[model samples]
Target: MMFKDWLKNKTTQLFFVLWLHISLLNLFFVNKRGIVFLWQNNSELNTLLTHFVTALTATLFYIAIIKIRLRLAEKKLTLGNNVFVFGSAVMLALIGFFLF
Candidate 1:
């Protein structure tokens, strides 16, 4: 309940969405193939592709989360909210690409 309340704030919503995005991508995307690739002399293009996939997954999660939260709140989804969420998601995804 407290956490949900905290998520209602604009900054918290952005941080929560972004952090979840980053953490989920980091947690599940790693695997044996990925490990082997990174361990080998992987090309920059391959590394870039991996980051792209991670960011895409994170962006999808962020959008789904924001939509679900809005639905649960019984609020009518608005254009402004959608735009804000999208922009935030894009920014977070880009940052995640660099960080991961």
Candidate 2:
């Protein structure tokens, strides 16, 4: 399906939100341990690469979340939409803080 058309579907919206939430959570925990391990081991190249990859992935996720929020905003805001958008925003913001 077209991206815009896919976004308009309620099932797609819910699925996107759920998937994003799980992925972000997994990324945060896994990255945290990996980064700490790398830091302690003092591997400069590996540490830098880890940070770069983490930042890149997080930035892509951030952009996708923004797109979802914008598309949802075009419709009347329902409780479901509010929860999904705001929850994702809060999670993304927390992850941003954790990263930097």
Clashes per candidate (backbone, < 3 Å): 0, 0
- Clashes counted in candidate 2 amount to 0
- Cα displacement (Å) at residue 22, model 2: 20
Q: Tens digits of per-residue lDDT for model 1 on 1-100? A: 8866764565445655665564444444356666322323233566546655655666667668777777867876445678779989998998999899
What is the Å distance of residue 4 in model 1 from its true position? 22
Q: Using TM-score as the measure, which candidate wins?
A: 2
Estimated TM-score for each candidate:
0.33, 0.37
Global lDDT scores for all candidate models: 0.61, 0.60
TM-score of 2: 0.37
Local error of candidate 1 at residue 30 (angstroms): 20
Taking the tens digit of each residue's C-alpha lDDT, what string does model 2 give over 1-100? 7976764564455545654554444443345446322234333566546655655565567668767778768885545778879988999999899999
